[model samples]
Target: MYNALQSYTSYPFAHLVFGEGGDRKTLNFDHRINILQIQGLKVPNQKKKPQDYSEIEALSKALLTPITAYTDQFSRMDNSLFKIIGWDEAWAPLSSDIGEATMDSGIREGRSRNTSFALASQNPTDIKGELMNNIGNKFIFNLDDPVQIDRALEILKLEKNEKNRENMTLLGNGECFFRDIYGRVGRLQFDPLFQELMNVFSTTPPSEEDTEAIHQAIQAHTEVMV
Candidate 1:
């Protein structure tokens, strides 16, 4: 998911990532990308210095303020404006009063503004009913726990049948049971067309050697394109 959003950096779209820790390093190198580290609820100021704050309201302010600004900037274009706002480990932030509102606003008005929210979390049930109701598409990945599966299915409004439970538990990595915008449900697999992206998008910590190799591969690929 991080890699998919990172791809937009090469284009004209605006992408903002809200995540934490070592994961930030993978997406931070590019000047076009903006990352909001969620730890301590610290937000970057105008000078790029993080100001630490503990208020719950701060979360919504940090996230929605910029999005509102960006929407105003791009929504004026003759054509639709395309933008992506991603939040990793989403459950925590979504629980807050204004955090959910921010998400709700994005999902509700996304179509007209041409914005996409890439929110990710381990369990779908952790998300609130109101926020989930606003989302049109859903991707259910593997769940080993039967309790979580039941709850997730209930929230998704799918039948709590054996077949559905079995299918979700049996899913392999990179595979998910998807509900599209039109509410059609089916299985889906993600296969990246570009092989070099696997290295760049990997969740594992990249060694110095691996970093150099991927950089060279991307350089070579870009050269070929030119």
Candidate 2:
């Protein structure tokens, strides 16, 4: 039986909302405190020497990007994106001449915050070592086996409310079928949060949007029924 809804404190469920990391500081140290202010911005300070307040202000004004080091001729914008603001004025004159950068520039992936959230919560027991390749690994469950099916059901049961016995029974078998057959080979990987999201999503009355999200989530995560 498939449950229409379940408690979201555990796996596949927790994995979805917080992702799989159980980690909170996904963003860099400086930006983490002020994430909203620095997604697509950049500011370059003076040389290594922090002679005075201007350098501190420059450091504060610019933002961190995917690439750490920036060249001489660089800019964030008049209010522009870090990469698109001032290309020729900075990069060419400097890069073409001394082959050294006077100004360096780049942009951080804005969605990094979203990515971190997707992997913030995870099941350490469900997680295996040596396969840290990614949180979302793919494996199909083979539910034909009764024992394994029970295990998967147990996971669902533990996470569901007491009132939803009917739904639990409904999807329990199918959950088993999926885990044993397709999911046994390896851990579902991508972002661990995908599983958690699906665990929550699966119980929300399978609609067109939800079903698609479930399928995608399932495809993206490594599955372990317990």
Candidate 3:
């Protein structure tokens, strides 16, 4: 997901606003992508981040502004001003008061503004009921857990046949069952080159910190020589 977002930044007019729990410090900060780091929303006197709903509310308002503006000014246009808003681990905000309102509105009305949302979550049940119902596309990965598999099957409205359930459990890495809004379903294997690129760009916190330190050291050395 991180690598994919990084690649997207290369496109013109593409704006990325990542939410909390994203690796803002590493990937986003290093790449200079705009991030909404919840940790930065500190309370005036308190030592911890803001506990009230205000922060998220502000974020929700900010997110809707562009869509609203685009809708008003360019509703007749065929293309969207902002192409995509990728929501990683979307369940967290989707369950919130502001998140529910923003997501609902975006899903229903964002198309006029030429915007679409891409949501990702570990469990289908974690998504809001309405949002889950309205999702046009779905990708089902391997799930060994009976409870999760049952939930996925229910969401997909798949017949509870033994063969279908077994197939869900046996999906290999980089393999997924793809379903489109029109009810088309098929198995897809991602390209090997794409998977290799993702693996190469994947980074953890410790590695990010070390990389940043090295970067700063190189900058300092270059400055001294200059």
Candidate 4:
């Protein structure tokens, strides 16, 4: 079926018509949502609650913070990405090693350029789990199937591209919301980055000075017990 939005100036309201797709031989599968006025039920004279500005502002702030933070984090993925399956666009999923070679052949900055193989979605968790599992250790909640992984990637890829960026959106993939309450920004590679920094601190190379700086930053950020 199809959905149609029609507007009429004088009527002061829009009409929503839902129906089956246009066919050469059939038109019987259509229905209009606002046909109630035709049935004499428009404006039943019920008083509605007035608008609440304070509540709206608070909710708006809460919602905007996370969404903006997440998009910003996605923008940084190319810097240290290893295995991202279903998160955002701007990166394409290739089917074979030929494609991996194609990407790595260019010396682009994305760290995930030459991954072994793009995991599929079936029982597999979304790109978040993919990244953690592929790069980190075991997880109790992480799913482990290629079809589920692919299915999730497809849903997220579609949701991300089709929706409005400035407004809130509802997203789902069989189950799971890619964009959630907590901001997705973090030292995602904290352990790995920390290890690398440690290794550099130990290694006698040109990067030893930079490694000392990273060690100081870690110490500065670490919490001290009172």
Candidate 5:
């Protein structure tokens, strides 16, 4: 998920934001990368954590602004903005009514605004049925749990034979079954070098020293370019 974000940020007029969940902190991307971090689903300097509904409402509003702006303009612009909203622990959010509503709105309305969503979660069952049904692409990694694998297969509409079941359970690390809305499906191996690069942007909390070093490096590089 982080790798996809890194690649998309390279595109022109791309705006990125992700929620901080679990132990993952806001990642420090390169100085040039304008990825925004929304902490605890609340704007900075708020006294209390926002209610679940409010959080989703705020997120939906943020996502729709660009779309509204572009459509209201007198002249259609060629260099239109694109927003990528990602959720790291996606299931937690989707479990709520507000979250599901927000996601459904985005999935339905995002394309007109040139916005997209990327979600990551451990268990497919934890995801809401509506959101799961709406997803156009899926990446199934190795799963030891039969229940989870079964749910994934059902969602993907793949036949559950002994051979297919065994393949899902035994896939190596970084190997996954990739399927798109266009009826394409295949097993893919992620490149080792690219995976290594993604590790640098991991959201897992880093030590204070490591965080400072990353900031300093980015600052130094930016200064050199200037």
Candidate 6:
């Protein structure tokens, strides 16, 4: 996403990424990246501590404030500004009642206000009920798990059948079963125009030692907090 927009000197739309840190390396398309931790909106390069109930509310409000502010400023469709607010590593936010409420309000009210929400999650089951209704487009990527495939189909509003199941699993890397806002369904492959984007979007893991070192660091931090 960042690579696609990097060429524009002046962005046509505003983009804000909401995540629990760790995107600093990959999200460097522009100098506007602000790593604001939920508490006091600190700009530090550290892994965030796990949130309890009170902290969850803080994080939820922090995310919802901008949406509310932007929506309130929209007097007319012509005068409204376009913005895309994305939530990466959305597990905790999706689980929170207040977070879900924030998203619910944003998804419902954002259309007229020219605000769009992008949520990235590995598990499709997390998207349920009213949240599922508001999602106009779905990109069903490769899934090795039957449970995830089932949920993906459910999100696609496709019938539970053998053919659909096979088709979903058949999707390779950068390929997806796309269902658009108009309910049109088709298969699509993501071909990056520039080779640099491959590096920007790659999920390839680091060496085992590097992984272990990072894990140990987080564990030590958690112990200190405890």
Each candidate's number of clashing pairs is 0, 59, 1, 11, 0, 0
Where in model 1 is the C-alpha error above 4 Å?
A: 1-32, 39-79, 204-226
Please provide, for model 3 over 1-226, each residue's C-alpha lDDT reduced to its tens digit, 9 standing for 90 to 100: 8886565343222342443454454322123234333322211322224455364334444444453334233333446245566666665555454555667777777667676767777877777567777778888888877778888887777877788899998898779888889988888886666765875756534478778998999999999999
Runs with alpha carbons beyond 4 Å of true place in candidate 3 = 1-82, 192-196, 200-226
The 10-residue segment of model 6 with minimum total lDDT is 37-46
lDDT of 2 at 17: 26
Where is the poorest 10-residue window by lDDT in model 5? 70-79
Off by over 4 Å in 4: 1-93, 105-146, 149-226
- Rank order (by lDDT, best first): 1, 6, 5, 3, 4, 2
Q: Alpha carbon lDDT of residue 38, candidate 6?
A: 32
Name model 6 segments beyond 4 Å from true: 1-79, 206-226
lDDT of 4: 0.31
- Candidate 1, residues 1-226, lDDT tens digits: the string is 9886454343222334334445445433223456655443433232332355444334434565654455344433333446677788776556544456667777787777687777899887767787787887888899979988997787656899999899888888689888877878888998988877976777888899978998999999999999
> What TM-score, over all chains together, does every model reach?
0.60, 0.15, 0.57, 0.15, 0.56, 0.60
Stronger candidate by lDDT (1 vs 6): 1
Candidate 3 vs candidate 6: the lDDT winner is: 6
Which 10 successive residues of model 3 have the least lDDT summed?
A: 39-48
Please write out the lDDT profile of model 6 over residues 1-226, one tens digit for every residue.
7654353213212234333356454333233332323322211112433353353344444554564344333322342466666666555456654456667777887787576777777888877767878987888788878999988888887998989999988898899988899988889999999987986677887789978998999999999999
Q: Compared with the true structure, what per-residue lDDT tens digits does model 4 show for residues 1-226?
A: 1221222212322221222446533212122111111111122111222253344332333333333343234434444444332222212212122222333322232343432222332233423433432322221122334454344444333232323221112222122334222323111112344666666545356488877998887887784531
Model 2 TM-score on a 0 to 1 scale: 0.15
**Model 2 agreement with the true structure over 1-226: per-residue lDDT tens digits:** 1232233223221222233455464533223232222222223323423355353233333222222223212222122322222222222122121212222112122122122111111122232222212323222233334444444444332333433333334443224212231234322333335676767645456679977987888877745432
The alpha-carbon lDDT assigned to residue 113 of candidate 3 equals 63
Each model's lDDT: 0.66, 0.31, 0.62, 0.31, 0.62, 0.64
Pairs of residues clashing in candidate 1: none
| Alpha-carbon lDDT of model 6 | 0.64
Local lDDT at 221 for model 5:
100
Best by lDDT: 1
